[model samples]
Each structure stands twice: as structure tokens, then as C-alpha cells.
Target: MSALGAVQPAEAAGGTRAERGDRESLFRPLSAEDGEQLPAEIESLCMNCFQNGVTRLLLTRIPFFKEIIVSSFSCDSCCWSNTEIQSAGRVQEQGVRYRLAVTSRQDMDRQVVKTDCATATIPELDFEIPPFTQRGVLTTVEGIIDRAIAGLEQDQPIRRATDEGVAQKIEEFIGRLRQLKEAQSPFTLVIDDPSGNSFVENPRAPQRDDALVVTRYRRSPQQAAALGLQGEELEEPAEPAEDLHNEVLQFNTNCPECNAPAHTNMKLVQIPHFKEVIIMATNCESCGHRTNEVKSGGAIEPQGTRITLRITDPSDMTRDVLKSETCSVEIPELEFELGMGALGGKFTTLEGLLKDVRDLVERNPFTLGDSSAPDRTQKLQEFIGKLQEIIEGQRTAHFVMDDPAGNSYLQNVFAPEQDPEMQVQHYERTFQQNEDLGLNDMKTEGYEEETGSR
Candidate 1:
């Protein structure tokens, strides 16, 4: 049976709601069979015939993706059928963009999960499939080309009879699209999903795919508004609230793990003689997940900050560390490096950050699948062992953090006097670094006149 057909409702397992709630809701194995049961259907008017038809719905979870409701409509009178997939999960914390190089016929056969909110762009042809233009689908890359061809051909006959010029241009475009499907030349397929639910198949799974690059980015305010995630922004006040900096302020938020309602506590903290910062902590009672984040309370510094610490003593792990979301971490001894935004913002000790890094690598889905190689697994094991040894003070390593925004901090044991083992340097940020931080696009100096003219 197909992946969609083999799935049954969560109730099939015969568990109480409370019992199932203990685990991730609606999370169950999708590898088994339950095809004997008929799918739930509802009577609906079919668009093809305007006649009464049946719409079948199935709730199934994709292997990599969360729960999704797959629906299919059939019209007996018109012999028409339509299938659609809708995400059943909550919005993710970050948007995902996938860039894939399609160079061969095998690449064309790769499966893709295109969510309704994803935009597929082909830079080579200057063609784009905008969001909401097509229903979400579980199909191969070739199938997408075929669908585009069918859409273009659907109205060609009418256009040809009246507007031959337009029809001719469309025909040429269709020919080019057909050539793309044949994989005659190398091209790029970009899927940008604001909902972070879309996916393109990776032929090399457990290992990194050289031809595919995946990036997660924070959505713009406009994009967040489009996704119905924009919250009310508090306006700055001329006067500060009484004791606001000293008190922990609480606010309601959804849990990232389970999307359950939770509370986040925020507090303003001053790092003695250094700078003020805002610390936020969230705890989800339902999932027992906790997270702490720190944001720089002051204005952006003129230069970037880089801190390097030599970890020689076990007490070094106990020192407080603030790793901003824009910080990149590295350990030269192990040849290990972590890029910016890998762990988001953190307000924790050195040991805690190292533990989080170890957990992130160990729990990565790519390292556990059938595509995982024995050699790769062994290497990861060795790397993880080294990290554990460092955490346990069995070995020495150099820890480096580079923050282009100059917001990260590492507590110094000898505060009044600089520590011999730690080195802090402030340097001008490069052009590319400013661009990555969105500083290049900011026009703070001339914004008054520009806004008035607009």
C-alpha cells in the first residue's frame, strides 16, 4: 500500500486521549498496514461537475514531517479526481529554504513535499510557482513539471482562438518547460517555505548532499503577518516602568515542542560593569522542555566581538557564557565548528552549552537513518567521545566565539583584572557580515526625510 493509504487514525491504537497525550499527540508508527478499513468520506459538490461527490480524508504523519491531513475528492459523474495535503502542525520557529541542483534524470525523480505556503522558483527559466497557486502535493520533481504543463495547456485553446500572440508565447514557454523535465541541462530548483513545512528529497540522506543546501531563516515582519503570526508590538515609552528592570515579567506563548500554551518569563539583568541584557526563559509543562534565551539590551556596538578561551581547568566549564543567536562557535583542537544561528540564543554556562552541542549532533535525524554509513557513524561516535571528555575535564580544548553583532559575552573569573587564558577582541565587521546581519539595508541616518517624502 502507498504511504498515505497505509495510515490509520491515532484511535486505531486504542489508547485513551490522556495516554496518547503523554507521548507526542498523533505521533505513531506509519510503517504498518491498516488498509482493510475504509477511509472516512463526506458528501460534497464536485467542482468538475457541480454534482454531489465524495471527499475522502485521512490523517497521516509523514516520516520527516509532522501530521498532515490528506484529502481526495472524486466525482463519478465527471470522472474527475483531486488530491490535496494540508499541514496539521503548528507554524515552525523559522522558515526553511531548499536549493537543489537538478542535473540528471534521477534528480528529476526525487520526491518533493510542496506545502501550500511554499514558493518554487526556477532562476534559469525565470519562472516561479507562487504560494497558494497550487495545492500542497506529494509528488516527484517531474510531476511538478507535468502539472505546470497541464495548467498552461488548460487555457491555451481559448487563448489561441482569440489571442494568438499570447498563445504562441505560452507554447514556447511550455516547450522550454518540457525540456527542463527531460533534464537536458543543469538547473536549480528553489523551494522557499515560510511555514517551514516544504521539503525536497535528498538522495544522500545520512550524509550531506553536495548538490542540495538547506537554510533556516527568521521570517520578515511582513511574512510573519502573512502567516497570521504577527503579535502586537509594544511601543517604547518615554519613561521606564517602576522596578521593571528588577522584576520578572511573564507572558503567554506557545511551546515550540508541542505547540501547547505556555508562559515565558523575561527579566532585565546587568552583567556587573559590562552591559545590560534581557533574559527570557520558557518551560513547557506538557513536554517538559525548557529553554533560556538572552538578548542584548543596549544598542548595537560599532565593532564585532570575538572571544577565545582556553579551557584548562574543570572550573572553566562553570563560568557563565552568553551565546547570542548570531554567534559562531569553534574548537580548533577537535577541528569542530558551529555556524551562526545553529543553536539560537542561549544564556547558560560553558558546560551547558557544550552539552547542548553534543545533544544536537547526537540527535540529528540524518545520523540515524538507513542511509547512514558505518564509517560516518564511527567518526561521529569518536567526535562525541572527545566532546564528552572535554566536558568531563579529561582533556583540554580552546573555545572560540565570533559574534558579528558584538552581543555575546563570556564571564571572566578575574573580572577587575583580565584573565590570562581568555582573550577578547573587538574589530570592524566585514561587508558580508553586515549584509548577513541586515545592517547594510538599514538606513537609520536618512529615514526621517525618506519617510516624509514617501
Candidate 2:
């Protein structure tokens, strides 16, 4: 007999009186032989189940099967009698599939037995198995079915061992599982399986690389509990150490010559192939003598010397001052040409100096004349006149001293306090004119000549 025909007697025998009464209320009763013929109301009830909440059904097609059963119950409340369903084929068509059974509760027993039938089609079985069945009958059924399918596909009977042997195998399996779990790095274990295709044994605990082996087997709750395993927990890496030596050096030293604080602080300046070198300059406020110091660690080494005309002109001169101590200095970028003989002892005499200045002007043509001002010829004329005065002063020194040969000329010409009255008057007039002309336009010409004088 077909599966539906096979279930007919069982359904009739087990159904409660209330169910029978309800059936009678809906339609006429059938003879024992005709019990396979389903009532016309059965399809409407099945349609109601479909419309209400039933998400899946298994339909078995059996020739000459007269009736099938349909019922709805939650998994928790379901019994064998109220769970089975019988239905009669009301409409038949070629290649049309039908639901053999459906349940209101998603997790209910969903197995279908197709007796005396070659094929069956079930539809819409997409609900999760109830949590309660995860450990009980459903688990056993799943294991049995899996083994059976494997055996059939492999065409062999799966072997079984004694309890002691199985226990030893399980212990070995657990050991291997633990090794796998412990072998993974902490970072690798934190990955989440977003696709639901893979399973992680410990979703919260990281796998250790040394003690565990990661495998494709899905871990059970018992196995996880046995290993005391949890999910992935990531650790934050510690911050890197800072270079304290560089920072400490920056705060301690002043310029070696100027005694003014060095702008580079104490951070060691490095030269290629030089070890732990620091270049320091000291400017003496009293004498304007700038000295350079090259040091390794704390030991000073005499590399070279630099002399800056801190008192640019006689206007900056004061009483004679001499250094109490000797020091080495370095004047980088200060260049002089051979055979120049320091023409008037100034930078203009240097051939390379003029070439560099000309190159600079050529490279930056925009600086040759003021682009904002309209009168270029007047500006050029004024600049030339200032240059003429500087040249005349350098040649004769009459502008700065009454007698160039007198030693007092150097001290008196630049004495700020000694010429305070004349300086104050000149400053007032210059300031007023500068304010009127706009300070940005008050250019200083012949600075090289004025400042270069010894």
C-alpha cells in the first residue's frame, strides 16, 4: 500500500473522539474501505493551514491512495495522533508537485515515509529546528540518517567498536580537537563566519598556535565544554617605546658662542660618516664674537671657527671686549675666492659671491624690480645712488670717520650712546617718513657695505 494508504488505519485508530466529531461536523463519514477517500472539506482546511502559518509540507504520491491527513500543532504540544495528516488528490496534472505534510510549529518532526511509492516532493522546509530537539530525538535521528546516507552512498556497512574502544577514540579525538583549537593564532581565531558555511569550535577564545590543531569538524557543546573553550577574545598590542635620548638632549644646552639659546636645542646634528656629532654656535652679547663647537657626546672637539660681524656697523660697536676662553667655530656657507685680496675687505670683492648673486637674480627675475610699483627707473636710480655712497665710503672711510688712520675712529663712529642726540633726531625723521611711505616700502640699501666694515 502507498504511504498515505498505510497511515489510514493508524490515523483512524489514534484520532480522538473530538477530532472525529469535528471531521463529522465538516463532512460525511466514509466506509472503512472508503476511508482512503478524503472529505471535500479537507482541501479547504489544508489551504487554511497554508494561509495561517504552515511553512513546509512533504507530499508523497502513491497510486490509488484515497486519502491523506492534514493537521496543525506546535512542536511542543504535538502528539502522533494530531500530527499526522491525510489528503485525497482532488486535482491531478502532469509533473505537478504537492506537499505531503506541513506543520504549524517549525521544529516539529518532519520525517516522511513513502511506502509503495517511488518518488516524493516536499516544499518550503526553511525553518530552524527547535532548540529542545538539538539534544534529543532529532539529534539521534540526524545521526542515524547521516550514517545511513553515508553507508548507502559508499555501499558499505559502517563498522562499530566496543564501548572502551569508542571511549579511547573519543579521548584521542578530543585531544586532537584541543590541539587544533590551541594551534591557531589569537588573531586568526577572531574571524567570524558571516556566510554560515563554517563553524568555529570556540567563537570567543582564540586558538593557540602551539597547542591546538584547527580542523573542519564542527565542535559539539560537550566537546567545547570538555576543552573549557570559549569564543575569540582579542588582546590589544602595547604601544612602542619612545626615543628618550633625543628628547632629553633637546632641553639642556645653550649656544656655545652666542650664549643665546641654540634654536636646535641639544638634538645632535649628524654629518655623514661622523658619529654622534653636535654643531653648536655661541654668540657673545658683549663682543659679538660667534664661536662654533663640534662635540661628540659631552667632549668638545675643535673643528673650525666662524666670526660673524655681530656689530654690523660702527653703529653697533661698544667698549672693547675679549673672550676669557678660546673656542672653535664653523662658518658653513661662508665662501671666499682666491686672488680677491679682500678688495676693501668686503664680500663684493669675491668673484664667486657676485656670480652667485647674479645667478640668484637671474633665477628669480621677478625680484629684479618691484612689480607692484610703476616707476622702475626711479627705483633703480635711487638704488644706484645708495650703492655709489657705499662704494665711496668703502674707498675713503670719510663718511664714517674724520681721519681713517685714527684708532678712535672705529670706537667713536659706532658708539650708540655717544651719538645719541644725532641718532635720536635722525630716527624721529626716518620713522615719520617711513610711516608716511608705509614701512614695507622703506627699503634699506647698501646693507652689505655698511655691515661688512671692520
Best by TM-score: 1
Per-candidate RMSD, Å: 5.6, 42.1
lDDT of 1 by residue, 153-257 (tens): 999999999999999999999999999999998899999998898878665432346788777887888788888878924446334568977788888887775
Model 2 lDDT, residue 298, Cα: 30
- Candidate 2 — worst ten consecutive residues by lDDT sum? 400-409
Candidate 2 C-alpha lDDT tens digits along 113-141: 22111112111211112211211111111
Residue 54 of model 2: what lDDT?
Answer: 26
lDDT of each: 0.79, 0.27
Model 2, position 194, has a per-residue lDDT of 15
Candidate 2 TM-score versus the reference: 0.13
